[model samples]
Target: MPDYGFERIGKRLFAEHLVGGNFGNMSVRDGDAGFFIKKTGAYLDAPGEPVFVPFEGPVPKDASSEYRVHLAVYRTTPYRAIVHAHPPYAVAASLVTDEIRPLDSEGEMFCPTIPVTTGAPGTQGLANAVAEEMRHNKLVIARGHGTFAAGATLDEAFLLTSLAEHACKVIALKKMFLQ
Candidate 1:
């Protein structure tokens, strides 16, 4: 069965232009078992066919390498959903700083101070990095990767991701003016 909440999350991500092509993933917790994440290689456009792998045991073999990041956030925070994306401005901001400090209310509200995680794909190292950073805030940058946001529901997660991207874009434009 299709998880309607997740499908809506995917659609919202697409609407925000946070996801382009097949780049990005989102997940929602599955009660006590774990979480259900989008399958590897699934794009936002094909929400109906999106994979919903259960994370009951270890991360599923076909789970997105970024799944560890989601697991880490959910484990460390009260978050029930996560949205990770390569939003151009946010990814650009991540690459520019080893740390991202919120320069506006949007950032202050959802992220405040964001940490940059370390590790190769699918490794616990990145998860640990995110976990440590998330102890202080709900958002973190994945170094060369992308941005991640977690919340109590898919809508909240998606909203935070959108806010983060918007904040990043505004910050980038402000920097341009300063230059």
Candidate 2:
């Protein structure tokens, strides 16, 4: 991750509540280093404190467990930034629905559809599953886990993630009214 870009992304995500209390991780590729990620347990509050690890070589054993998901998305998409967040509305939708079809214009623009990835946690198999699901969309819900969003920059990724969360909330509200 470029130092400045990293800082910008961290602040944006933190401000959006996509990342806080060390709950999520974000990364961007830096030259031949592969990607730079936040150090484990690092809160987004201090955007300048993350460590950039080289991805061209072996991943550090202590790397974030979600590293595989981030790497897979980066490799499969044109996205330069990837964000994984445990957003409330998205999480609630994921638990109750296997598929979140586009119910509004924002969903169509940011995510035409949101598929659910299935697999055990912290495994490459899970990453592959997510990559496959993401082939047709910019956002996805990891079943009972969380949400992932990707874009040309971290800000775009964060925007898409926020859009997905808002979409979910709208869908939830609609369902309530229908009942």
Candidate 3:
């Protein structure tokens, strides 16, 4: 398994409050071989080693449960790294809207529109939805689940993931203030 910047990104995810405990996962593409993913239930903040999963054959039991989404994404898009995080504001925003239109300038520029996709966690349905969206958009939020951001590298993907939470947090606060 390669660094692909997971250690740094993992720390950001935890510090930014995008994920709690071991709820989120990440991966980096490995060409024809497969991908290097966080092990199931591994702490993102201090993930020691990553597990590899091949394109064919059985997936390792220890692989993150969300590996299916990562595999589907790599198979369909040119992105090299994928970050899946359960951003509180993003998930809360997804619960009420079909999409998130950021009010902040940075959000508007980098992630002006984040579509909320629907599918159960760790299922093929979720994988397909996220993969298809990732083909065109770098960031997507599974309804009430989390945010999935794809990029050329883990750093890039991590940026999108962070931006997503920032955008959603602003939107949520705005809505709350207005109400």
- The C-alpha RMSD of each candidate to the native structure, in angstroms, is 2.3, 2.2, 1.1
Q: Give per-candidate clash totals.
A: 0, 1, 0
lDDT of each candidate versus the true structure: 0.74, 0.74, 0.91
Instruction: Give RMSD (Å) of candidate 1 vs. truth.
Output: 2.3
TM-scores, each model vs. reference: 0.86, 0.86, 0.96
Local distance difference test, candidate 3: 0.91
| Top of the candidates by TM-score | 3
State which candidate has the highest lDDT: 3
Clashes of 1: 0
In candidate 1, which residue ranges exceed 4 Å CA deviation? 1-4, 49-59
- Quick one: ranking by TM-score, best first? 3, 2, 1
Q: Output the TM-score of candidate 3.
A: 0.96
TM-score of 1: 0.86
Off by over 4 Å in 3: none
